[model samples]
Target: MRPRFITLEGVDGAGKSTHLGFIRATLLTLGIDACFTREPGGTRLGERLRELLLAVETEVSLETETLLMFAARQQHLAEVIRPALVAGRWVVSDRFTDATFAYQGGGRGVANARIAVLEDWVQQGLQPDLTLLFDVPTEVAAQRMAATRELDRFEREEGDFHRRVRAAYLARAADNPRFYVLDSTRSIADIQSDIAQRLAQLAEQP
Candidate 1:
């Protein structure tokens, strides 16, 4: 099969970071040339933008926040993701446009239509071939985040915000054939094993 664009997504504390590393390592073991990157920080400019987005002390309007995310996304796509895919390398991203939809649209109450407009303008219809959604209960996510030392701007939001984010992710997964929802509450070994199996199937596809 040709190289594919793969994305991993979830609300904060869903264990996406741990599994992202696993997926990258497994792809290497399988001898696939994969370029691993993360949203809001794939390029130098994107990384700077990530800092602004995540800073707890920084206050930004909802529209500004959403637009900044897309700005970083546009830069990431132009500089990293698209080049890797065009060069016949699989691109595995930590998050993508789906995140904007969930966090901004669902959690922050931005209209889906506005986000759709920006998605069209920035991505020009590009989308991941496969998306792995790490699904954990909102309560479980809350506990996980609470255990962490410092919460980012998004993480500082109340429970209702996270609930909406999770709901939005699940609703999108339901509508998209390319989405694979994984139970993140499972043991790490078990979850990684399942993810490896899924990757194996993808490798086998014609």
Candidate 2:
């Protein structure tokens, strides 16, 4: 049996990481063998790439950034994700390709065609079986992020940029049945319960 590839996506401070932990616990309670990971840092090489990508001092062009992200993702998939999924362990991720589309294409105003080309090349044929997108208004997400620690490079982008990113995520979810959009403004427990229901529905599928 192939492992289910589940991915969680959201803007910064949308509580994606919190939900990830909740979902992991839920899966364990249900007796599912699962592995939790995140892109661009799931392996050693990917971790290094992540640091370079997120570091405040490191400056790179949008094209360069997008390519580097994919480079890290390729390594992550080859080293951790694909292997675990092949081994029949559920692979849950913090983020995936949609992130690139949101950050680079939407926020940075990169051409969608360029991003699609790179995505096709890097991902090859692999795609998540389920993608849960935690959606929140740009202002709300910004407020939440501000309440946290100092912002990273990506998180420091202008408000308009984040708005574009959120819009892009919604557009993608609107077009893809595999994508599930949840309101992150709701209480954490409510979000977790809704996620549990979604997971149960997935488990019921043939």
Candidate 3:
């Protein structure tokens, strides 16, 4: 099978993180070489930027924040994602450009056109072969997040902000044939079953 690029996306607490291990294990079990990584922290420079971006006390202008995201992504693609795919490993990322569109464009009111310009410059024509969107109600997502861990700056945003993010994600999913939206409100086993099927199909793809 040709190496594939996959990205997992969701609003905070939509349970995307909970399923990463399952996806990795399932791929390994299927004998597919896969590398799992996350955006904004896949490279050393990106990790430093991620720390600053996630710090609750840190404040940044909307445009600066969006630019920073793309900067990190540029480095990530060079140092992690592209190399993995070139080496015949399926590359799975925790989040990608979709998160930028959702958080900056939808949640923070940055224009989509501005984001698209950055996306084009940084990614060129590269795009995920598959995007797994784990979707859930904002209320349920917030509740799940609160029960699990202390909130980060982004996760601590108000309900309305999160709602916009969710809507933005669904909007992107609707327009993209590469996306597979998963209802994360289901049981873990059920979700993983669905994920396994998706990975199997990818493996079988010519």
TM-score, every prediction: 0.97, 0.97, 0.98
Number of clashing pairs per prediction, in order? 0, 0, 0
Model 1 bad stretches (over 4 Å): none
Instruction: Spell out the clash pairs found in candidate 3.
Output: none
Q: Write the per-residue lDDT of candidate 1 for residues 15-78, one digit (tens) a residue.
A: 9998777888899888897998998899999999999999999899999999999999999999
lDDT of 3: 0.94
**Runs with alpha carbons beyond 4 Å of true place in candidate 3:** none
Error of 2 at 84 (Å): 0.6
1-206: candidate 2 lDDT, tens digit per residue: 34799999988878898776779878877678788899768999989999999898999988899889999999999999989987889899889999999889889989999989988887788889999999999899889889987998999988999999999999999999999999999999899999999987776676
Best by TM-score: 3
